[model samples]
Target chain A: MKKLINKPDDVIREQLEGMQAAHADLLKVNYEPFYITRAGGPVKGKVALVSGGGSGHEPMHGGFVGHGMLHAACPGEVFTSPTPDQMHEAAKAADGGAGVLNIVKNYTGDVMNFEMAAELAMADGIKVQNIVIDDDIAVKDSLYTAGRRGVGSTVLIEKICGAASEKGYDLEKLSALCRTLNQNGRSMGMALTSCITPGNGEPSFEIGDDEMEIGIGIHGEPGIKRDKIKSVDEITEMMTVSIIEDKPYTRKLKEWDFGKNEWVERELTDEPLKKGDKVIAFVNSMGGTPVSELYGVYRKMAQITDKFGLKIVRNLIGPYITSLEMQGCSITLMKVDDEMIKLWDAPVYTPGLKWGK
Target chain B: MLKKDHVLSWINRCYEVLEENRQYLTKLDTAIGDADHGNNMHRGFKKVHIQFETLQDKDIGAILKSVAMTLISSVGGASGPLYGTFFLQMGTKAGSKEELSPKEVAQIWRAGLEGVKMRGKAEPGDKTMVDVLTPVVESLERDVEAGKSLVEAIDQAVEAAEKGVQDTIPLIARKGRASYLGERSKGHQDPGATSSKLILQALRDSLS
Candidate 1:
């Protein structure tokens, strides 16, 4: 608690004020303590997008606000969900005349709060839709237990869907993209150390100098198991295998029969795509993972992707998403088409995320 | 005779135990798991201590509910939600009661045990808080059925809890971070079980 702070009560407010001062050109501070929207609002006729969650995972919902990403971001206290009031303000602020879309992670409190905000917005005749991100494969009995925890891949989905919204794809297309990403993308993480909650002034979990946590969530939620610390390569392989096993790239798309009509399967006519299958690769660093280690992980991921005959059409590497200082990273790969490749290269600028122009 | 003040004193005593053992708990976690049990418990109990000030006008259930919420929000680690859920469940069962009789205390303990099971999804052999708590609740209920006084029943319950905590040292962990160790978890005492023992011990000491 010896850190610099005027008061614990004003921590979120002070941080928001500092963010406004630092990036006034890129963002506008809303009256609500944790809400920030783009200065000019959503580009006219574009789908307004809003997202937010607990505060400790910085640069997530907030930093990703800008022209190409989110129109508004709402933040909660520490790991707590932002109240409905904050979300309502954010939804109102980001309405670009088309409508508003909420990108919410699948945490119980976050879902409940965002749902409340959507309800409130609807009361005022605002058309709002929501897509929940739940990409973590680590949590088992997910359909049974509070559903899969939304982990690192959320950042990737935000960027991809944001790009789609910017392209005037309408609510249906944005929702479809969101669902496709959630269906295709999977993430698993491991932690070398526990995060220290700022107010608590100590690590959230105790990791022996030698031990590491495998399959950890962002909240330092206990992972699938704790085992002896493994080398970087082993840990990376473990995570990758889990993800791949869950969502293997079935290059072949099967045909389905409707009640009245049947569609034929699309055959991969090419020579097994030596290195030309477009793929967007994301190497997401959990909060405590450093840039150096994240790069190291990418190096390994590149090798693995090469082995599978998939070319890395685009790569995003950094702490795009985090779990409050938890030491780990998750890798996300989306097999892309020519259209997606073009969209991925489209220009975009946001405080927390940025891509090709 | 156990008075209402004694129950309140037990809460304070449990806070003291968490404060005193914070570092030790963290150190133990450091060896085999993420090292935050001690710090998490410390942060949670510290919040609980502050909550007690505002709970003077509330009944036992309200007091426990406050403790549970504070722990859930303030403590981020597994222990926070686990312990918080335990107390929250206990409070839910305790309802608006001013004070708990021995049988009621035993039932409250059972509720807490069930809550932990629901939250952590741990069983008796999981080498978790349940290993210690389940035994104490059973012993307390048995003691009460045997016509023991409230204080005596609690004392016997504390003894059973201590033994249950000790049993965790030689057993392999089947749940939580310690389970990641598999056979390696056998030598170290389960931090959760240890804390549960301390909770019972605090209650006993407060009664004296």
Candidate 2:
């Protein structure tokens, strides 16, 4: 309940205003139906990338809105999905005459809102396609549940796909590349503490001092199971093993069929990881977990990947995607091809993630 | 007969009722799902309440359509689209109508219920708003078929919704965030169902 904020109602708006002030050179913020887009406006003749979700996960969709990353991000209330109007407006703002690609995470609210937005945008004569990411391995049944929550892999998709767009990839090609990345990535997380949303003014879930929840999503929702607190190595091993050894996930996902101009359900499957596959490993914090401790988790992750003969050709460690002050970390392993590696190494500049020019 | 004023009264009653039960619904959600159902519902209806200024002279269909757009734009969770679609379908069914007979009201409820089902894809026992809505719609339809008055039919529908809320306490969740908990989701009342009951109660109170 105790946090630094003027009021619960103004939290999102004030934060966005502060972000606009701090990063004016990089992005522009639109209020009313809130969304953030690149400062100089949409890149001409390039496929624009747009993504969004609930607000608590900071430095994600918003912070990634800059050069070589997301072109626009629609932020909703904390832990709530953004409405269709925001996305529709953002797509209109970011479309560069090539088309627009919506990088949606696979949550019920997020998917439904984005689907509605896609419909709205298409009706406006804008070419739009949606690629949903469901890379978390924690949820066991897609048929019975909302399916695995999209976690760290979203960061990777935005970065790599952003680079692809910069390289003149068209809307259809960008959508296909996004699907490939989603199929190859898996993530798992563990939380030592719960997060308090500003509006609720309470911890999302209560946890015992001596316990931790495993298989957690970015939101402070309770994970698959709770267990006694273990050492960093043990926790890392559990999460890494789950990601590396996860079975191929098959689920029915809705995609817009341009031919019919409607949403259609298609069954898609993510292939599992195996030995000799090269990967870009990402270790992320859930807001409150410090980078120094993430190194401890990463140290163990590096050793485990070596033992499994999975080559970690690239690695990103930090709070690239995070929940609001929740003490936890998640690890994502995305199998990479030569093209993906080239994209990963491409020059990029954003507030949350910046390197290589 | 359900008149335009009655529909407006129902919406205003929903805003007040949801605000009053906000914490209680959030508490219910804390047990089995993320603890935001109350806040989400209140937020959506609060926006709907503001639109009442512009809605006073509109037809029932136009009023409900405005409410749907407000909720869909302002409310940013699973509840937003589910409830938004409910109102949208109701508005579509009641198009250009300033008043409705008992059967028309029943048909509107049926359309709203089916819209919720299609949007959330939850069955009757999935411990969602659909659980409460299904029985409410069925009760209204049955009562209307039996030549009941508007007040009488709505009263029976509210009772059915109340029972539906209680019925969810023992069932396992198979949809939404609560389903993530598996069997742990049992024993707690579904927050969505509870709020749905309030929606029906608001209608009954409006008619009375």
Candidate 3:
């Protein structure tokens, strides 16, 4: 309940205003139907990459809007999906002559809103494609729960796809790369404490001081299991092993079919992590978790990967994707090829992520 | 006849009910869903209230459609689209009529229910708003069969909807975010169903 904010309702707007004021040289904020875009905007002829979700997860979609990253980002209310109008206008503003690609997280509301937005953009003669990330191993695919919740892998997709777009990759190329990244990555998260949503002014769920939630998603949803807190190594290995030993996950997802000019269902399966595979080991703090604890996770992650004979060729460690002040971390291992490796290292400049510029 | 004035009264009644019960409905949502149903509903109806000044002289359908567009734009969660789609279907079915017959009310109710079902893909026992709405429609049908007046039929429908809301207290959710909670969703009254009851009660009050 204790946080710095003027009012519950004004949190998102005030934060956007502050972010725009601080990073005005790199980003522009628009209100009424709120959205953020690159300062230089609609980079002509390059595919426009747009991604968005609820607002609590800061420095994501919004902070990543700059050169060599997301062209525009839609920020919704805290933990609520943005409306289609925001997405439609952001896409229209970000779209160059090439096309537009929407990187949507796999939550139900996000999927529905983005689908409607893509349809809207297409009505105005814009070529748009949507790729839904379902990389979280936490939510077992069932007829009950809506597939896997998109988690840490979303950050990896945005960075890699952003570089690809900057390199002149067309809509098809970028969309294919998105699918490739999604199919090759798996993420698992755990929480030490629950986060309080700003609007509700209450914790989404409760956990005792000694308890921890395993396989948690980014939105403060209760995880798969609650158990007594263990050593950092033990908890790290548990999630790491869950990802490594995870089996092939198969699920049906909807993608826009340009030929048919309608949304068509496609059953996509993720390949399980295997020995001798090369990967990018990403360790992310779930908002409240500090960098020191995340490094502890990555240390254990390195040892575990070595034991499994998988090589950690590249790595990213920080709070890129996060829940609202939740105490935990998620690890994503994306099996990458040489092409993806190059793109990951490509020059990029944004408020949240910047390198090789 | 469902006049524009009555429709405005219904909307005002809805806004008042939602404002009063916002915290209670949100507590219900916290047990299963994302805990924002009451806030979203309150915010949506408040936005609808703002447009009343411009919509007061418009036809009943036009007023309802304005509410639909406002809800769709301002509310930001599952309830937003579901309720928005409901009002849009109802408004469109009611057409531009300044006043509607008893039969037109029945047709409009059915269309709104259809829109909710189509958008959410939820059934009667799925523990959703549809649970309350289904019984409301059935009650209207019964009152019509017994040759009751439109006001009487609508009153009966509101009571039926209240019963339906209570019925959700023991059912498991099969759709929306609450569905993810599985059996944990049982015992908590469905937020959407409770909101449905409130909406129907507002309509019945407008009849007086």
Best model number under DockQ? 2
Docking class of 3: medium
- In model 2, which regions exceed 4 Å deviation? none
Off by over 4 Å in 1: A1-20, A24-62, A65-151, A161-180, A186-278, A284-304, A321-330, A336-349, A355-357, B170-186
TM-score of 1: 0.66
Can you write out model 1's per-residue Cα lDDT over A1-357, one digit (the tens) per residue?
A: 344678755777888899889889889988533589997755788888889887778789888888778889888766666666678878877887777888878665566556657767877767777777766677654322444667776777777777888889887677767766665566777788777655456676677878887777776766677788887777777776566556322222222222423322333211212345566778877776888998888887777777767778888888877876677887776666777666667677887766564
List CA RMSD, all candidates: 8.4, 1.0, 1.7
DockQ of 1: 0.06
Encode model 2's per-residue lDDT on A135-239: one tens digit a residue: 888899987778888889999999999999999999989999999999999999889999898988888888999999999878765577899999999999999
The better-scoring model by TM-score among 1 and 2 is: 2
Local distance difference test, each candidate? 0.74, 0.91, 0.89
Chain A TM-scores for all candidates read: 0.87, 0.99, 0.99
Candidate maximizing lDDT: 2
TM-score of predicted structure 2: 0.99
- Model 1 over residues B1-208: C-alpha lDDT tens digits? 4456766888899889999998888677655555557766786688788878787778889888887777765554466667777888988998998888778888889999998887566778778889999899899889888889988998888889889988888887766545544566777888888888888899889987
Give the chain B TM-score achieved by candidate 1: 0.95
Clashing pairs in 2: none
**Global Cα lDDT for candidate 3:** 0.89
- Give per-residue CA lDDT, model 2, range B29-127, as digits (tens): 878777788999999999888877999989999999899999899888788888899999999999999999999999999999999988888999888
DockQ value of candidate 2: 0.73
